[model samples]
Target: MLAETDIKDRYTSTNKNFWFKNMPTCKDRQFGWESNNKSVLFVNHGKTTLVDSLLKHSGLLGNGPNVCVMDSNELEKERGMTILSKVTSFMYKGNRINIVDTPGHADFGGEVERILSMVDSVVLVTDATEGPMAQTKFVLTKALQRDLNPIVVLNKIDRPTSRPDEVDSELLDLFMGLDATDKQLDYPILYASAKQGWCTKSLADAQEYIKNPPSDSQMGSLLDTILEYVPHPESVGDLDSEPFRMLVTQIEPNSYLGKCYLGKIQSGRVRVGDQIKALKPESGSNNQEVSKITKILLKRGLLTEEIEEGIAGDIVLVSGLKSASINYTLCSPSVTEPLPFVAVDPPTVSMSFGVNDSPLAGREGTQLTSSLIRDRLLKEAETNVALNVVSGNSSESFEVRGRGELQLSILIETMRREGFELSVSPPRVLLHKDSEKNLVEEPVEEAVVDVDAEMAGIVIEKLTKRKGEMKKYLEVADKVRLVFEIPTRGLLGYISELKNDTRGTGALTHSFLRYEEYKGPIEKARKGPLVATGPVGTCTSYALNLIEPRGKLFIRPGEVVYPGMIVGEYNKDSNDLEVNPTKAKQLTNIRTVHKDERVQLTPVQPWTLEEAIAYVNPGEKIEKERRRF
Candidate 1:
């Protein structure tokens, strides 16, 4: 067993083969983010919780004789999910390792791709109980394409129903299905319980450990496996000689430090105050600006240590670069060879973000002007390589395009929290031209749904109506797993409907499979909406009681209402009906004989932003929303 405290505290090693031992001598080496030699990228499909958990379980989060860096983003902490790629480092077995934690959800796939270019290898984390999921396949395909060998970690193996052997087989099938190379297919697998903080290379050992849990070394096998399987940075890059070059993978703004460009050094060495040039290959101007590096920060543990110089194959944060964008190469002035830029996955969904033109427009937010909205969007586009922001014909509107509705919704939620009032149009799929210049509307995705066997019929019916082709169906432990290749446009509001149909027991996962020709005229028609009538007023239970029998209500009593605002779903027909929610009861002979005279109203189905965006298409057209706010 490895000494956890020694591995956690004394990370720096004088071993000649250790990467950190090769750091260049320079002035002002107060050791702030000083460059570390080894780096590994952690890629998962939402299997693990904290990126630092694997290391922290081994006593790596505290003031280590080795440095630690952990996820500090407020949004990530709040959501309990990684919204962006986070960089952290730790020392193990006389080696310094920089860990890049990438988002697991497909919505943030672009972040995973960008971070892969900076590291030599990846740790592919998968859930043992669920096996390789939709996102697991998606992310694994990316890693294989990048030619990065993977070290698979079968996480959550301590679950009562975990089938490690079955999951292991499924993973093999996935690798072969994705056409992985033989070397990649022969990947190493380890069993772990990230929550329990123990891992073992052998399944039998893991089972034994579960019976008598080890208290001393919680995650030694994982660290050892990583060190054994993941190659050293020297094997991936030319550390001996090359100009100082790095492809900026992320750009972050700091009030005190201005703009900081974070990436791994591609070649040579860069010292603080070293003159570096920023090159934009896509800008088409051959324009380059020479600037002096003011500060260099490196990954130590959970925090960054200031370093004077950074060598090749090390991830570092460099300050003094202005307007630094993703894929921009920061290199020595004499270095002309630019690194290959990572192609951004094109946007499939678009929504118009316009100024809040409702009756209560400026009442909720301060940043309501088009100029401020446009500036904020442009700033986001600079850092978020996956997003596209283009101005609409009208000054008040800007079209925001992204991978999916969830991605766009996250942006909207972030802006709204920042006091920005905006009316978002219904999401529309962006059309693309195929190889023959044929008009293509959207990409087709493979949606895999698992639900109670009894509820499978309704799910199939719903999906079939949405132009989905059922590919396979299987029964597993009283559950039915159905696979369908469905059009992306049809899935916009399908989540809410699926939950309703399955009584919240269904699980759905989808991934972009391929782009196909326009599937013309998918039937998206449904019943009409119950709209609010006339002028703005407050809703009352008296009116709600009368309307409860006709449809489902979205508004509660005393809530502010507006004309044309959809209050509920009209269950009767396709025609929209205006209802008087502000109507008061007649005073004469209106007293009820029963005590507790509160009007009994059916519980209203509250609509979230995603649900509201999906429900308001009046004509079933794949365009903007017709419901007025």
Candidate 2:
């Protein structure tokens, strides 16, 4: 081990080419190539070892922090890894486990693709009841294509209905469907309730496993299983920290730590003041100093703290820099090669985000301008590699695209919560060019629906009418698996409809399948909206009573409403309707006794962010303007 006291020459510079000019002296290719169709060289002389990312372990390797847990955003908490948090380290026996906690949702599948490239293998955790959700299949297929040894943790096995045996059978079937070799069937498995904090060989070891279940189990039973099967990534090449190298996996600006980056060190050792080169992931040979790291540290759960040294394959925190971008490669200035980066999927869905044009636009937000939205999105792009944003051609709007509707909606939801008033465009699929120069639209997903056996046909009929090709229908555990290859447009309205059809008991998961030839006109949503046409004032019971006769109401009496605001679904299948919010009943002294009854309005539908996003129409928008109701 290198002595901690030994020092290295270091300096900071504004030279953007610092990374390309200062290549570290090394004997072999130092960094791993990120796979996207083919592996592209990511970091040159910085030695990187493929790791399984063993998050929970029995023993530690070196002084690197052994326990790495994610501190994710509230949005991520809801969407789960639609953005991922990766904390790095190697477990005992020299195995590098770049622990990646990915979102369970398929919408954030891009995050999984990118994070998986930085490591060697994956530990796919699934609830015993869910048994390899739609995302599990999507994420696992990517890992298998990389020849990654998948270690399955049949988590939540302690539940009364948890079925490890059935799940194990299902797991093998998933593996076989993904084209796994017979050897892969010998894969290792563990049972754990990560919540309960214990893991065992099978249900039989329930007593032993549950004796203690800390988020970080120290008994080492699970870690031992991982090490036994998930072979260590052979240390590739040799590069000393005479210079330092790293990949920027996470980014944040600290009031105390300044600009910081979190990632596993590919090669060499980083000391405070070491002149590290920050290379843009897309930059082939060019690298820049941008700034210098003032400290070496590890993300100890939530925050970063100073550390003595960071080695290859261990998660690290570096500060005292200008700014670091996700997927950027940080390394010795002399290294010429860039580290492999995961290719994030192009956003299939998008929304127009601009200054909210609502009558109450400026009332609820701090910064309400197109320029603020532009600046914020640019800053987001600097960090979030998955988003694609552009100013509207007409300049009155901004076109922001992302992986899926849920993904884009989450962004809008986050901005709304942060007090930003912005109007978004209808979610649309982004088209691209194929090798044949065909005008191919963005790749849609294959929605896999698991519902009660009796309700299978409803799902099939809905997807089929929406241009979904139901390929496989299987009956298992009194539930049916109805798989469909549906366009992105078909899915927009399916979630709510399926929920209603299944009575909220159906399970659906979708992942990006390959882009097929343009599959004709995709189906639009079925329901129209009840648009309030003229005025800014409180909605009254009398006017609501007139409109409630047409469809469900979204606004109640005494609540504010404005022109161009979407009030409720029109119950019909079209757009552009007009209703009056300021309309009140005329008082007449000649009214009959039975006709004198007060106009008691029906209940107004309270809109949650997800529900509103799901309910929006092409011409109408989900306004987040504040109101008393």
Candidate 3:
């Protein structure tokens, strides 16, 4: 091997700003994040080791790449906003560790669900103090339902106040409470402190027991356990049973190939130029027919490398198979039985991705025409089965439904970055007719709230208005843990109020729950928004001073403002009022003695993608600005 000469050079790095012009590095020398995507591997070095070792081990000689899934954005780093499941690989067990790191937030559960179907198992990580929190329950429950065995790892065991024993028992109990079957009850537990960079399989060992010297540690044990325990699914099916088969999982964009179809090869073999019929989803059972595998691709670590004759179990990419979708079947003539498909959760939230009716609709984006927007949405629907786009007219808008706010937000954000200009309506729950054909609209979701005992009643009271029903209550240390089955409809706009009510000390977790019967207009909780009546040119401190007495402003001086644009929020009952934020103050030549000179404008109320989606009023809409180039 030409080792020394070949290893002469090393490198680096994108984000929401695919089209934006490259920004200069910040004053701190740390440039804001650029691009973000799922790393396609798992069980990274940091997956088992502490975070610091991940740095050292990945760079033992040269700069390394066995790093864990991370978001470099300041907001993501500080607040940990992983709205997507980022997959990455780590070298372990003499094999590549293909792992998917799911988000801790519940809103991103859709991302987690979509990615989980790709893996065979999951390591249920829990905090020693909090044990398996609500999100842990949400993710674990889905994992168990899919028959994926969970390897439990109690993290943060190094803290002096960490109660490992209690957390262990609680975790087991939580698993049971989630309707885990007898066979799923017993799971392996590992004590770990990601900061300490150590783990042990022994339960009798002290929670504080960690290898002090970092150089003395290794990831051999964790790797060995995964290799020994996690049974690799049969990559290719029985050779004699069929010719070749695969499941269409994800669709990728390629310049030469156009669309790259991602999936797992099941059986037989696929070679380039092989004649195979595309098995349409419409045909009856055992429906797959003849088509051709135009091209074959493989994943070399995080990058996609083209190949021929890929086997089963390994995640593969293919091209020339047009119309491939999540559940579509790809098989040879010799194969008849279609693979059982993994069904993603139905979307509970829906909103209209409509033409920008705002006066400045076509001003911001190039792809602002209705036909352009429709083409983009239809293209997305063709690939992403999870997204549903309802047909609408040129004057009307398209109704898009997705699992949650984050999913819809991602859709909007992606479209915006692609030069699309569209306004979105508020997200409403997608209701359905059960087998009985009854009108069963969804209710508020189940919420797990952790708050001080003194604040418990008020939290419950606020939840009650939102059609919340209690599941069970627990008292742990100085906190009260209560679970409630709340209706999803009334929960909208409640988060901000909840944070305000609890003084930002409460923890709330929620997931979509099965809908029973419809919950009547439970309670009407509404707030007014500051609407611009006339065309705004620019905000000024003097003009803002006059408008400040009316309500709060979203745009400070120097920021551009437009009519029909929501400039601020009014602190009052449900009522939208127009205000002139750009009215220039009538100047006077006469000067007065000694006075406070400057008037401070209120800071703009910057909204997160999800929050802005939620903040949309009934007839109002959300305007998205693509990262500028």
Candidate 4:
């Protein structure tokens, strides 16, 4: 093993002043030090664009329409948002840098929490115009609590309305508000426009790059800052001599290689065919099993390349472990103690998933049996550590709990696309009992809303009626940012309403806070649902024309409807109203001149999976069909 002095000298003596005039060829640097830095790009503040630009500038991606490689899932592409944490790596100046792109939405906080354990530092991407958002605070808090080094990137500096100076100041204030330590307070900042594909260390340089078109990309400065600020794993100790140990952070099923577990090597080294033991520390010390490694893989660019051996500090994928799971430790047989694992926050919302029992159950989807649904849900729970599944009161239903409604909705959508049919109930906040106080507590969220100054009053009034308490309000130019502590259940279907109230210009985000004393009953602001209560038949334009005046219709003239199915939302009443949408106009022996006129029916509004889930109330279930509700 190298001495501590030698390790320190190795990094200090390397090419600290090297700058990339152009992309370098794939060759190892003569610096003898194996520098591998693992960093995570977190938050929704232009991380995807920055990641794509970095990969392109590194020559890992070719010039094109700037595809977001991290969001490879179909649903992610359709929604233009990330729902899962993805791993990718690139080589810069002969150093291997692993980057984990995590979900930015608060509902996927579980993904961000687990991946933080495997990364050494974080690149907290914040918007130049919006400054720190709700998700920005959520992820930054997690990174700070772990005492990880942070590098801030002020993205979208090229926007016409960008305010880098003010945003930078706000960022510093946020750090202080979060009680950051002296070391964390002193973070490095970079200015860039990821969409334009350039970044610089100083504001002047960024402005110059924006004014004068650079023949080559200027992302080298950001890469250099990362290598310098993020510490190498070897700096911890003589990790090469320690026993082989790795804590599984993520698990993915492979069609050809079975299950693949991805994690960072905490200590020692492991090679293909090496024998290892799987230890479940949370379950019990006696629950241990032996296994052999079949293949070792390392992420290169957007794909995984098989490697013969993996050393400490490197994130790798290992196969051939049949029973290994997340938070479990894979280590040398001689090592009995497992590495410490960070526990994620408990789920705040839950929904019921049951076998499709509607009349159209087996018409559209092929997988309709209860056993098939149960197996698929179990498989999902095995890899998704944040999600919990428990059997419901009957054999046909299961309660699925997660961080929030969006998270659960994404899972349901994924299952729907996979040819699985299931009924999903509206999301409900998971409540707890405070034993000492003998009081019931519900989950509360820290909500951040940005709306036009003119609409702020109505926004505040609406949220107040839902039991939301405003904690802080600030005016930014013509916009107002309001922070509130509100019950989780109060914000169930508020997104659509907020958009309507603000004319589609309002933005709102929230994150889990803590369980507090239950607030007294708050009246539901949502209107009643228009249920179709009649024999199964096709909808008629004559009947829908009359119902359009009562509320918005969800079905057109030719769509099929059945009893107990929600057809539309009632606008005037707050009680569930059953209407016969299948009723046809009585035929007349003699037709008047107006009777020959065509029926002028309003167009029906389609509901996405998330919208449908949010629109449902108690005792209402959204059926899974090829045609969305």
Question: In every candidate, how many clashes are there?
Answer: 15, 29, 28, 0
**Model 3, range 552-606, lDDT digits (tens) per residue?**
7777787677877777778876688888777776645564433336887666666
The lDDT values for all models are 0.71, 0.62, 0.61, 0.78
Per-candidate TM equals 0.88, 0.82, 0.80, 0.90
- Choose the strongest candidate by lDDT: 4
Per TM-score, the best of the predicted structures is 4
Which prediction has more favorable TM-score, 1 or 2? 1
Give residue 443's error in model 2 in angstroms.
Answer: 2.0
Superior by lDDT: candidate 1 or candidate 4? 4
Question: How big is the positional error of residue 208 in model 4, measured in Å on the Cα after superposition?
Answer: 1.2
Q: What is every candidate's alpha-carbon RMSD to the true fold? A: 6.1, 8.2, 9.1, 6.5
Worst 10-residue lDDT window for candidate 4 reads 29-38
